[model samples]
Target: MPVAECGRPASPLIVVLSGPGGAGKGTIARMLVEADGSLRLSRSWTSRERRADDPDDAYVFVDRAAFEVRRADDGFIEWNLFLGCYYGTPVPDPADDRVLLLEIDVAGGRQVLDRHADALCVFVDAPSDAELYRRLVGRGDGADRAA
Candidate 1:
């Protein structure tokens, strides 16, 4: 292991940002990583289709079968099934020295905490319920799902 400025062994800081959909978790995570070169946002893999407005690097889009195969192979550090879609975070490389940022949901946060007790978890929320619903619907989620 590498030593820090104080000479103690260095380890990556796992930071988890979790919240309901349309709560701006992704936006916050992106800003944090862009502002700090040492913070790396781990790209999540999803079985859901990528939205048209989603950035090219938003996620590692994959088919359900491929996602299932990866899950069976223990490729994910945390995984969840939401609204008929599978979402998971791949295990970060052990050699990576940068801090890791995970944008996930409540259930995934629990799983990460179970494995990494030292992780810092932040819960993000929208300014209001109305705003959250509006954001969700604007992002193409059905009204029922947004509600």
Candidate 2:
């Protein structure tokens, strides 16, 4: 992948947002994506147990067998076992000019950076850990606070 003048990938720019569980990475990613039309959020596939209040749009919830099938077929660009469940970013299709935002863990972020050297890696950090925890707890609705 070729790096653009702005330090992002040329055609299919992979933007990775990652941080601690309580960090504001997801919030920032959502804000940037909602404010911009060019950015597209890659929905993740997960084999984890879903919460009662889990957002329907958060992930494409699948059973263990289905997740294993995708994993065996290498359908994911990057996948990791976190909190006893599997999470992965689907392989992205070629885009003429579009920024793909991936909200994943640090491990997955490193994987994207390694696979696509030109990809831009953004680490969203809160002012303090306490503040992050507060924000996580204070999220009104549709926030994945359980990790």
Candidate 3:
């Protein structure tokens, strides 16, 4: 509720885009950031191995130990362990001065909501289970993991 000298809200609006795997959350997040000059996507950190097809900037890749160390230091706004890998959204830099966009899962969204009650949360879902599986496999995820 803080106000800036320019008469705007001091804190950037927090937007949480969450969904199950293969639900197009990443694509939508990218589109939203691209279309809005005042919005910035906060890249997430992950301990999982980067896939060959993944964009270089998709995540701030790190080893599990490093991820744990950051978690211990309270560097993440929300962090979660999924399928034996760790993923987290880092706390926004105060100087960024833009609306913050978070692309994460439901659990992470819940954590963010617990801390920032006013965050705008959007849940994306695939049109059908079969299509979700197809998207997952097409994206290089193993069938077992996709399921």
Q: Note the Cα lDDT for every prediction shown.
A: 0.90, 0.79, 0.90
Candidate 3 lDDT score at position 120: 86
lDDT by residue for model 3 over 58-136, one digit each (tens)? 9999999999999999999999999999999999999888888999999999999998887889999999999999999
Write down the TM-score of every candidate: 0.92, 0.80, 0.93
User: Weakest 10 consecutive residues, lDDT, candidate 1?
Assistant: 1-10
Selected candidate, larger lDDT, 2 vs 3: 3
Alpha carbon lDDT at 70, candidate 3: 98
Per-residue alpha-carbon lDDT of candidate 1 for residues 1-147, written as tens digits (9 for 90 to 100): 211222323678788999999999999999888777778999999999889998999999999999999999999999999999999999999999888899999999999999988888999999999999999999999899898
Model 3 alpha-carbon drift over 4 Å, by segment: 1-8
Q: What TM-score does candidate 2 get on C-alpha atoms?
A: 0.80
